[model samples]
Target chain A: MNIERYDRQTILKEFGMEAQLKLQAAKVLVVGAGGLGVPVLTYLNAMGVGTLGIVDNDMVSLSNLHRQVLYSETDVNKSKVVTAAQKLKEQNSETDIISLETYLTPENALRIIADYDMVIDASDNFPTRYLVNDACVILNKPFVYGALHSFEGQVSVFNFEGGPTYRCLFPEMPKADEVPNCNENGVLGIVPGIIGNFQALEAVKMITGIGEVLNGKLLLFDGLFNSFQKIRFSLNPENSKIKALQDSYDFNCEVSVNSITSDDFLQLLAENEIQLIDVRTPKEFEKNSMSFAKNIPLSQLEERQDEIIFEVPVYLVCQSGVRSKKAVNKLKEARANAELINVDGGMNEILKHAIKY
Target chain B: MEILLFGIAKDIVGRSSFRFEEGDEVPKSVLELKQKLNNSFPDFGKLSSLAIAVNSEYAQDGKSLQRGDEIAVIPPVSGG
Candidate 1:
């Protein structure tokens, strides 16, 4: 270890050489390289954490450059894990950075997490959050949890020394479309930086025995108000009794909506006049939409059910396939027997093929 | 009683915090508070998971409330 590199943090009387040594010996895994994972990995590596692992299957898009400061304009369209690992290595070569270019699924979560001492739930989706919680609980490992919603952010330490788990705070994963993600809702670039730093601080505290960790207490920060609130919670014994992973962590598992590929939908469109509903906002629909599709924003789906023909299969399309699936689910509730099919990949996929607007 | 909203709950309510004044028929329990919010804003009912905190501590549905108690409605956030 380079003793001079960590002299500043080690010089503190409370966090002396012992704490530095603990941070050097700790092995932590961060499960996303987008917003929260960037700061967590950056700080942990710069502070001389021994081993760090990054898991993500997403590519650095133009939109990610705001909060994901690790990636630049040149890094767009590149794999997030690979780019993050390379950048982190340049920041601190002494820290062993392991890059796992895959999403944490039920099958691979346990095996991947078992190699690390601690996990950080920095993912941007509820499925991965719940998967991380369950996997950490089953493996008897502690995880630093951080999530964001627009200007608000949440940070918590779960399964730390028998403390409360994420399930204890919010029992079930919120259904798809219940809460919009950053991609859908939007987040201030600085919000995740603030929250991720808190997560890194908690991880260091837990590893080095510094200040009190946030176990059983959820720290909520509202940037708009410039306020912080800590909600105290207790562990539900039932949450810790998980012997195995659930069969599926997919958010859309609850609603079994049939789907068709954009290519197949186009082929069907040529053969027959299909009833397609574009569920994107008016602005999005006006920007680009198929001539045959009807514009019905998801926000107004409930009131405009009469416009959609329930006699034949209704095809739903959005910017991405997410909102289309949500539309299918919503329509299913109103007309249970209605045949609804979500256009997979939505307009993004359809645009790849030759088609007339 | 003052109710604070976080995450999607804040968006659904359109304000960070609100109050039920002295003579108002405030919710007596966490469950009633949720029901009231759901009744006013149907979006609250759509959220599959929500956490209520009384005096900055997690409160179950049956947890009783008082006039001066501070309540927070927190829904799960799925952003990084």
Candidate 2:
């Protein structure tokens, strides 16, 4: 590697040659090649962070071009990790870039994150964020957290050597619907640039051991006001609740139909006159049925248009809420006039309530 | 009490503002203060995940509150 390429960063007294070499030997994994990941990757790569791993399952959309600088208009439909790896390589061949062309799930997250010295949570969703935080906590790795919405951004270093985990600061995840995403609420392109760069700085600081690490503190940035605030955090012993999150997290976060009781269902049924549309298999429907309900097995619902006349509100019921939600979504796509609701408890909940066939 | 809004809350709520009220008693928990705000401005109930702070401190969900303290409601942020 040519030393002149990083003369600017090397000149800093704190980040001298020794620190640069540490950065060169560092293996960092950046999850998500979207808005925040773009700047974080670019800065780290430019500063000669040796081995970089980029993971993302999404391709470039037209809307993403405004903030995702690694991609161009021509790379619109290309995989983000692939395109980003290629561009980063072209800019600085000194850095070895690896691209994982798949989504990070609980099953594979531990292995993938375990290989890296540091992890950056640049993904957009809460489940993935929590997964990254938990995996890092379990493995005892340092993970940098950065998040941006509209003109504001938050950066924190969590799950590092007894430092605060995301769970310590926020023990519970929020309902998915409470927050509007970039698709619904537009973000200023520069907002991510500002945040991602700060994340990159944190990554470098963590690697080189220079400057005050965010550790248990959360840093807030406002692009609209050009202001920054740092809020301190402490490790909550109850955050140990995250220890059980290792393997069986699936059951821990699984959506059960049991969340809503039979009484709640009855109230909704009476108040909204909600009609149950069982989308279970015909054999399953024959085994049990709800009174005042229509049987439209999921397999035949698409072909049997006359079976469902969507004049009234429909509550979809299946073995679990998963298939019913899909059926409801399909019904909505079919331009049905009914408002869709998923009886989360499905047949199990119905059976528990002793609903007659 | 005064509250600060950051990230998603700052964006959606437009800007952090203040309200004038008088009370002798301090609240038992941050959730109670949150309820008071939600009742005062019903529109904010939609932002249930928004985290709150007391006097520039990261406020816990069920922690006690005091009078004349500064408070801020920050939503679950999604940036990086």
DockQ of each: 0.90, 0.52
lDDT tens digits, residues A197-221, model 2? 8789889989999998898888878
Candidate number of the best TM-score: 1
Best by DockQ: 1
Q: Name the runs in model 2 displaced over 4 angstroms.
A: A244-357, B8-14, B21-29, B42-50, B61-67
**RMSDs, each prediction?**
3.5, 11.5
Stretches of candidate 1 off by over 4 Å are A260-296, A302-320, A331-357
Cα lDDT tens digits, model 1, A1-357, are 989988998899999999999998999999999899999999999998999999997777677889999999998767889999999999999998999999899999999999999999999988899999999999999999999999999999999999999999989888777888887688999999999999999999999988899999999999998999999999999999999999889768767779999889888888898899999888678867999889999989999999999998899999768889989988998899999999987886686553344
Give the C-alpha miss distance for residue B34 in model 1, angstroms: 1.9
Compute each candidate's TM-score over C-alphas. Answer: 0.88, 0.75
Q: Report the number of clashing residue pairs per model.
A: 0, 14
Q: Fnat per model, in the order given?
A: 0.99, 0.56
